[model samples]
Target: MGFTNENAGYIAAQTAKRFLDAGYSVRGTVRKLASARPLLEDGLKEYSQAGKFEVVEVPDITVDGAFDEAVKDVTAIAHMASPVSFFFKDPEPVLHAAINGTKTILNSALKAGPQLQTVVYTSSITAVKSAKEPHYVYDESDWNDYAEKEVERLGKDTPGPIIYSASKVAAEKAFWAFREEKKPSFTMTAINPVFVIGPPLIAPKTESAVGETIRLIWTVFSGAPFPLPVNGFNFTVDVRDVAALMLYIASSAAGGPQAIADILRKELPETRGRIAEGNPGKGYNKEYTVPDGEIDINSEKGKALLGGWIPYEKSVVDTAKSFVGLV
Candidate 1:
């Protein structure tokens, strides 16, 4: 239940739509209801939402009791409000916001009463294990203890990506630990998504908008050079799937950001000249140019499906269509 006037955000807006379409009355939280509500409502106009949808102001989610009133009557919750851009050199602020903001929501959920059943948190795959060089396959049993240690030893000197991974590692542990200690009746599930990219449901047409992950693709379409390592390192989950909490990625699937650049070049005419012509067929798995000592991690699709996922190409095309005029 997070939104901003300028950036309603893809996952946030889509999560709200999924709930509303499923007939749950939603009481979303916003910092400023005046501007955010109109945009959120406008974005959901396509749905014949069965239940009422409304929003309230919860100025700061990190504050204690911030969600008390907002969550009082809800049964299930999808909490994806933590920011990913807090790449501050100071880990305290990042840690505090991620950890404390998580507790604040769970605390409110605890007080929300006996009907509450599940609280799905938007966790990162980094929470499983950081994708360091010599990438390895990670299963459900792995925890990113490496990031925690690296951050601790390096302190502010730790890379921002590691710190991000560390915070998720910390926050998800904190989530499960709270459950084990407190033994709340409601179950908690953390959805760990890898590099989230897809059509942004609510991002504006402006190229400068901050929230959509697809904007990275925009940078490429605008003639920026390939913005990733020669062999791209990211595995993606669609923002909509992440929002819906329907991911089923096993430890054996492997595609990266470079795949998107290639997809865009093939699908979007506007990007034909603007995007780079990487080795085309030989890009992924380095049938073309494998980096020295690099390894690939693979994953199978998860068995469960809230319907199969949106294919990456469709996600890419729709994302490009969403920004149709901007190039």
Candidate 2:
């Protein structure tokens, strides 16, 4: 799902690659078949065999029964797609798309019957925690009720991040609620990934064509002012890890933008003057960068999910090299 998403495109393709690599057929869902088909096909061209991959359109994901036919006979599902547009200025559309898109899938999954043994939901760290929270360790049980309250109170005035936080919370809640109430045969699980970083699996044609996260990294790496104001929350995981599974804070933090600049300069000499040296001598301090609410992670659990973590340094360097290689 969301095979064309700026952030999730790689996830979708990589997920498809894993499935196709294992000799299973994959059916990807998109809002528009014409625009997304070629992109997904091209993205998975290396690993997907002729009859092993196909795409179907589910133009309106918010509607009930939208995924009925798409879900038919499928064994497992990775619901990584969402219907919300990137311009999340309006809360109503965001809420509707997030909640309803999730419901529609659950409804279709139920309609698919016992054949569907698993439904792995694509959830964000936003669903688990909010930027507004102080430094504290968070685990899977936590919920970002702060963002939901703000969305309810702030409406269109809410900040973009908070709005996104609220939407993820609501949608994932909707997903779990359906599972608990319906008790469908599929095992319902939501993978809540933090700031995702790494080189794009599919090379973008232009700098402006990269995903939102990489775009943010590019803004800082190119010595350009942020296209928008970003906060100082920088905890991160690699995009490849997120797909196989699944940064904002700044200076002196783990996965910080300044860290990206420094790595580029150290690993790629060409960045000497091309990228600004915001700060030097900083190290990757996970505890220092841990959000105020804190975090609780099981080394074994995380390894099982992403097959072990990809170091943030590698993710940063690879992202820079990818952008430089972009046409």
Candidate 3:
């Protein structure tokens, strides 16, 4: 279950579809039933006939006990809600929402007790890769030092991206802390995906960080800017793949957070060569640098859960195709 509709992007929608595909009912949280219905309707249209999806209104995720009622009797939760935006005048709000919203859900889940066996959280690659510096190889073991520093020094004047990164780091950290403190019976898994790019379940009208990533490829296809690739943004995974990975983790009775995180780490780069091959050649602007590192996500636990990742080229192609329809 997602925390709120507005925060639930393509990833959340796609993850919900995976659950429905597995013959499970999905109950997503939203601030307003009216606004969220159209999006949910579009995303889960195929499942509507099966009557597997519903929405619960939790207008304020930061409020204590906000998710208490919504989580009751739920077997699993995909906590795919977090405030992310391109424009935030101050970092405090973003930090507060991400950190507090996660705590609120964990608290409610504790109250949920026995029925909640798995809690899957949507974490970002930023949580693992320090965006400030290029690491040769990053894995589930690395927590972004840059983000940790931002969280330590969070104030009114932090940069938007840093704040966003820190929010992710803080939230994930909070989840682990809560898990240790509360020691709930449920299994906790966190899926740390890179800049996810693929055809959205429902197309968005406005540009977002995700939309911009799609546009970057289009910029190359159209030969608009014959310049260089944007710096430090080399990695990406398909939204659908990320969704499927989450589903696999949630469905796996023995799956834990590290196993889930490790699977993606081990498999994403295997598809890296395809990214360059799929590119139109013009898309490879020299300005940006590709990440350097070999992450071995091939643990026995990860292998038991799933296979390889979705091809990067396929994800970019699908994203470009979707962008054409958007404009």
lDDT values of the candidates? 0.66, 0.68, 0.63
- Please give, for residues 1-327, the per-residue lDDT of candidate 3 as tens digits: 433444555777777877787788888887777756655567686676566787878889899999999898888888877876545557778888898989988889988867688898887766776643333555567687786576467576667777788888999999889889988899998877766667777765554434544555544433243334334454556777777786321111111112222222234444233223222323322322232342322122332456755555456556555544433
Each prediction's RMSD over C-alphas, in Å, is 3.8, 4.1, 8.1
Q: List the residue pairs that clash in candidate 1.
A: 248-302, 251-298, 251-299, 252-298, 252-299, 253-298, 253-299
Misplaced by over 4 Å in model 2 are 1-8, 46-49, 83-87, 131-135, 225-232, 246-253, 283-300, 304-307
Q: For model 1, how does the per-residue alpha-carbon lDDT over 11-103 read when each residue is reduced to its tens digit?
A: 677777777767666667776766565444677654424336666787787898988888876787777676575355767778887888888
- Taking all chains together, each candidate's TM-score versus the true structure is 0.84, 0.86, 0.78
Q: How many collisions per candidate?
A: 7, 19, 6
Ranking by TM-score: 2, 1, 3
Cα displacement (Å) at residue 4, model 2: 10
**For candidate 3, what is the TM-score?**
0.78
Q: Any residue pairs clashing in model 3, and if so which?
A: 1-78, 136-292, 136-293, 137-293, 229-285, 266-297
Considering lDDT, where higher is better, how would the candidates rank from best to worst? 2, 1, 3
Which 10 consecutive positions of candidate 3 have the poorest summed lDDT? 249-258
Model 2 per-residue lDDT tens digits across residues 172-233 = 88988897898887787788776667787677777767777667677766767424334434
Q: Which candidate is the best by TM-score?
A: 2
